[model samples]
Target: MKTISIIPVIRVLSWIVFLGLCIKAGAVLFTFTISLYNPPYAADLYQGLDLSILYSASRLDYIFLMAFAIILSSMQAFIFYFVVSIFEKLNLVRPFSEEIFLLISKISYFSLATGGIGLLAHQFADQLVKNGLVIGKAIDFWEGRDAFLFMGGVVLVIAQIFRRGIDLQVEHDLTV
Candidate 1:
């Protein structure tokens, strides 16, 4: 398939991912808000994921947990937004532009931030579990922390390449 044919497919997939993350973040926020007032709702926040034990143990912990979920999902969605933008700005014949470089760099930073936060949140969950909170499936939120970190590094390198590509393109245009 031509590269042009694939760009739209990838862009659509990115949009789907972005929308999914946004929905997830919204669901978590909604569940958290409801659980705060209803209490029993905490037993099954956002589809059968229970945090009631942690809720009963400490409201602060519960809030922090939900905040982590919201923040991570939102950050991932934000990263995908940049991904879509990158695809939108992409030109197969002239791929490197300052805007694309900035967008890629932004994605790298956001990915790194998401990974770091995920690691911290995972550690926090482990501590809670050790302390007898039993976060259960909630701890799975950061399961992709390592992957995000790796992607961040890779994207950072790509951003640097794009920067050089931009320089080269400018030089070529001047020579022509």
Candidate 2:
């Protein structure tokens, strides 16, 4: 029986953490988008929902979204460290050594950064629009950011899967 190394265990755990973070970030963005569509009041007199309740719910939703972003960013950084550690243990794909992991980490960081920025921008733009201010471009920009964040989360997940595949391949080769 062959003993599994601590390194591989850590690598798998890191990927799991990364996957969780991505899911969380995605959920936050999705919730924010939904909140935008569900306004407090509608002229159609059928569903008698309380305006104050709806407003409070949306406010709470926004707060949760912001918190999710912060948590995801912290998890991303931890994942980055774990990725580098895994690479070192496997001694594979060291063309640029830690530099490659660093670059990937930067990409993750940027995605989270832009996502947070977009959320804040959207909030303010929404306020301006509610105030009867003419601000078309701000809304457009916020939408763009949301799109960027969603895409970024997807790309990161793909990358993590690819890396896991490589690890499995290495394990197979060692066994054979």
Candidate 3:
């Protein structure tokens, strides 16, 4: 009987995530470009469905919206990159090394950072509507964004635990 290593599973899942994020980024770029440039054609091609993120936006607004998606996707992909890093960093050697904790800690903060940006965007939307200032701004976030902020706090605590573990490991090594 042989034991199965989990590293391969981790690697496979990370690859799936990486591919998914890339597809999403590419889709945003392609769809927004086509729909913005040729609205009627894109409607016919996509069965009358468009990205919908830039609904009610003018041509200039659509351009800014695409720029926003590029920035948003870049940030979103960064989180996945951190996930891939964690998976790649985990192995038979130094599984709990400083690199892992540092990476996780970054994941924690970046997750919170994204969530915070989403929150701010929402607030800005509210202000615009309240002021009757039609800036043609349209933005939204995942339902899980608030949850991401909460999880970031939890991960920060966990990173502190790992910091202690590193210190303890150092002490233990010194004693031997």
Candidate 4:
């Protein structure tokens, strides 16, 4: 039986992520433009949608909000890129190689960075609300970040396990 390599799957997923990033960029640009130019039309489009939170936003506020969304999307893209790197390294070399370990560590770091950034963004939004800049509740940027932080820590543990497997492989090789 031939084992299926996961490289192809990962590459496909990376392409999907790239596609999503492009779409998000376009949508953010369009949304910002609409919000700035036609408040009533924009409100009608968002009717019954929670984006009505944006109803009170000024043109500058819309620009700032869109910039925040772009930054968040970029961070998510970095996370996907890190996953692709790990998959590519695993495809080209031993799965237990040090390079894989380093890649996993990078995944952890990037995940942490994303979660931290989300937290900071949420805090900033809160401040904006407090200052009466954003009239309604700000979007919840930090809601799902706990999972990312946890996943980063879990990846570090998995990397350690892979390192131990490397040691076992070395021992088995030495026995020959």
- Per-residue lDDT, model 1, residue 97, is 89
Number of the predicted model whose TM-score against the real structure is largest:
1
Cα deviation at 92, candidate 2, in Å, is: 12
Question: How high is each candidate's TM-score?
Answer: 0.95, 0.37, 0.72, 0.66
Candidate 1 per-residue C-alpha lDDT over 66-138 given as tens digits, one digit per residue, 9 for 90 to 100: 8998898889989999998988888888888899999999999999999999999999898898898878688
The model with the greatest lDDT is: 1
Candidate 1 vs candidate 4: the lDDT winner is 1
State the C-alpha lDDT per candidate: 0.90, 0.52, 0.65, 0.65
Candidate 4 off by > 4 Å: 1-7, 22-68, 135-142
1-176: candidate 3 lDDT, tens digit per residue? 99998878878888898777777677666776676667653332222334343344454544554455555555677878888988877756545678988988998898788777666555655554565434332444233468778878888898899888888877888999
Better of 2 and 4 by lDDT: 4
Model 2: worst 10 consecutive residues (lDDT sum): 42-51
Tell me the lDDT of model 3 at 152.
Answer: 80
From the highest lDDT down, the ranking of the candidates is: 1, 3, 4, 2
